[model samples]
Target: MSAITAAEGNPQIEFWFEFASTYSYLAVMRIEAAAQAAGVDVVWKPFLLGPVFLSLGWNDSPFNIYPPKGRYMWRDLARLAARYGLPFRMPSQFPRNGLLAARVALVGVAEGWVAAFSRAAMLASFAEDRDIADDAVIGELLAALGLPAPEVLARAQAAENKQALRAQTERAAEIGLFGAPSFRVGEELFWGNDRLEDALAWARAGP
Candidate 1:
């Protein structure tokens, strides 16, 4: 079952995203308005794509391994970001380490601030070019959200919370997710930032 399976019977969409995914950064920025317009509730599910890629025999991001694709992705992202009026900049690092962010996101999710926290983290990476893997960055985001940084960071790094995040990633795999910025409306899945609107429509229509 999906990590958000419990949301069934509602006009809800499961937004499965990776912090390091360029396209996920796009989707996370505007999902709220889109979902609201479509009258769909969105459940943010943050999971690691590194494990998913490993399952497909990839040792690293396909974009990095393939120069042409990497170039195309950056170009496409710039064009799309411009179209959406969202600020975006190519980070100095490609496919950054998002483990700490993912763990902390689960804490944000439980605390009812995942949406804000997720957007801030993405902005920090794609818009501001900050190192999200740095604890200082994550701490700054938490503080902005009016959360106690030290306490939340401790909880986010707890053994149980780490295991919980791993379990969510495992569930994403079991549900047949092959990429980030994916959406699940009941059993139907949509991939890519471009499909976000379609996913919201599906959610509004129900299964």
Candidate 2:
């Protein structure tokens, strides 16, 4: 099916994603094409889910806490990745520390490198099976995106960027977004990659 098209007037869609989230990778890789066909503009909002979990008293990933879910999630990710023609390999780390990556994303968003940096970081983690928690990997990703590695790294770790990342996370919580890959069209909130199409449709239909 094709993406949604607004009948009269509609608000743009805001896609919130986390680098450490597997399903978000699938959504990020596919959402652009869908948006283009729908004649909709997407606002990419990169945020950290750690704070969201913490607010719910979760110190670890739900998948790790629930073995059955973890197993199913990995398998599901592999299948989806394969279906999308993207590489499929689970990283050694279950939940890589995404703080640095979130900071970098915040910097990128501010500097208009949001999409590029987000794609590179996601590819490194999901496709290449790279340890995204490591600064070196992130630096490599920034370089590959044609960004000044040192400068980006410095900005990512800087107080301002870190605060911005934290603020984004808090804002997500305030907006009732408890998960990754959430799409918001005006006040409407749709969670999960699977709901992307529905979110677009809702966008086309207006608030």
Candidate 3:
């Protein structure tokens, strides 16, 4: 869904993530530092998993539709979060709307602040249990980054930005992405937070 490649000779990996994805929180918080250590570049791809799930004949997160799966997933997520030493709090609302935040992220991508914005947004929803769908919350995120909230928000909400996000999501589906926190090195796709280190290793090794 997104890619961040560095200059020639530097290895890079595409980081595909959705804001509502629980595991993505772990990946998003961890990728930057890990990539830095591996000397690899990361591309932040923010895409909507709703449409992808719909394509698979599912209207909601698999965790929500199946009770047992949902229970196991929450426990697994908590354990993993602790293992990584990242904070995790179950949000009252599962899978909060990320449309607005994703759009704003496209603007941040252009302005070179996507990473900081993404981390803040994730922490807001996953750590603080904030309603990320709220425009005010996103606005606060941008302003906190020293970005001009009104101006940037205006750009993010523009018709063109909306179209861009749509295109990005469509591309995600086209590229065979069925989930978030996926990593791509060339044609290879590695899914899940656990595979993150492997993805970075793949990029670091080069072709």
Best candidate per TM-score, number?
3
Index of the highest-lDDT prediction:
1
Report the lDDT tens digits of candidate 3 across residue range 160-191. 99999999999999999999889999999999
Tens digits of per-residue lDDT for model 1, 13-127? 8999999999999999989888887878889899999999999988899899889999999999999999999999899998899999999999988998999999999999999
Model 2, position 148, has a per-residue lDDT of 95
Better of 1 and 2 by lDDT: 1
lDDT score of residue 116 within candidate 1: 92
Error of 3 at 41 (Å): 0.5
TM-score for each of the candidates: 0.94, 0.90, 0.95
Q: Which is the winner by TM-score between candidate 1 and candidate 2?
A: 1
TM-score of 3: 0.95
Estimate every model's Cα lDDT from 0 to 1: 0.92, 0.84, 0.90
Instruction: Supply candidate 1's per-residue lDDT for 165.
Output: 96
